[model samples]
Target: MTRDNDTERRRPDVRTSLDQWLDSRRGVLRKGIAASTAFTLGASAATGAASAQQDAPFGAVEFQNQTSDGTTVVVDSAILERGGFVTIHDGRLFEGQVTGSVIGVSDYVEPGGADHLTIDLFDVPGAQFDQSQLQNTQPLVAMPH
Candidate 1:
């Protein structure tokens, strides 16, 4: 009768050990799934940002001139720089062709006085823009065109 009771006790112990092992494996699988999901989401976000940057309409510096003559001149930030293409949205400047090089940045201030960023536009001849015209202008958008 003592031997029979001992066998019964050992059987329960073995079953408990097996259950613990299975639970540990399930925990490991859950962790692996979480890690994989995080990696996939991170990669997708990075790719989206890169594609948007490539399609961005604005550059480091954009020029907007509203003339009293009812002509508006929109210049691409890159074209104002040497050997770069500036996209002209309206009437031309400097010639009927309307393209210029960006020479440098100077006296840039944050858009909303938020102390965030300052940007200056310059011509290839080293002439800096006053940037006062942009004060009343609408804030630039971050979305790509």
Candidate 2:
């Protein structure tokens, strides 16, 4: 009982300090996230600067995964570039379903290789976006989006 009371008293202080720290360090955190190239709704790409091909239109790069449940829609990139996002405010526009998105290219392991967008699908079973929702995607050159 005494330990519980003591912990309860300390919890508020811990939370307050944690909140303050997070508020002050939000930009750094966002930058880290952008660098990782895992963009979810409400999170913008502040680091990876993608410059797409001259004629390619700016759109969401999507992927489809065949899960046991059904097909899951995933958004991997902002068209051809890293920071090529049109906007991140409305998750719906990007088909950002309830689960959220963590984006990347499948072939980032190779320094100079074909770029295939890889998106980690979250909760929603139904969502839509660009590029035919390829089951077997073709590799694109590792060019800036």
Candidate 3:
């Protein structure tokens, strides 16, 4: 094949592959931005900084410590600046953080908030420790993600 023809053939293939890769990366970037925004806003809300700006990114989760059947958790409320989900984790505070496996997750919550939210529990796949160790008997931490 002529050098020009070979170059033309390779150009489209490379361009198409690059375009596909970029598209996938854009998706990942969008998701990462959303998550970071949520986490940042959630931190602000926790410190009472984002209470007035309802349109701004913010998240808050509130629930009382209680017992459960290891199958579900009740959150008094969950506030989110955008569409997202809330997760339940063991309330094992170590080094100022909840060092525990996910116990439950709520379905997609729309922008705004939900009252008396109920999250279904399940052993997260590939847990480092047995789920039962943190179930029923320990306090659970509800977080917005």
* Cα TM-score per model: 0.17, 0.21, 0.51
For each candidate, the alpha-carbon lDDT, in order, equals: 0.33, 0.34, 0.64
Quote the positional error of residue 99 for candidate 1 in Å.
17
> Model 3 Cα displacement at 7 (Å)?
78
The local distance difference test score of model 2 is: 0.34
lDDT of 1: 0.33
Query: Candidate 2: misplaced stretches above 4 Å?
Result: 12-14, 26-36, 40-145
Clashing pairs in 2: 50-82, 51-144, 51-145, 52-145, 80-145, 81-145, 99-123
Per-residue lDDT tens digits of candidate 1, residues 55-97? 3332233333333222223333321111223222112222322
Stretches of candidate 3 above 4 Å error? 1-56, 92-100, 123-129, 132-136
lDDT of 3 at 105: 68
- Candidate 2 or 1, higher TM-score: 2
Identify the candidate with maximal TM-score. 3
Residue 139's lDDT in candidate 1: 24
Best by lDDT: 3
So what's the TM-score on candidate 2? 0.21
- Expressed as tens digits, the lDDT of each residue in 31-93 for candidate 2 is 333423443322433432352122233233332232322123223333433344322112331
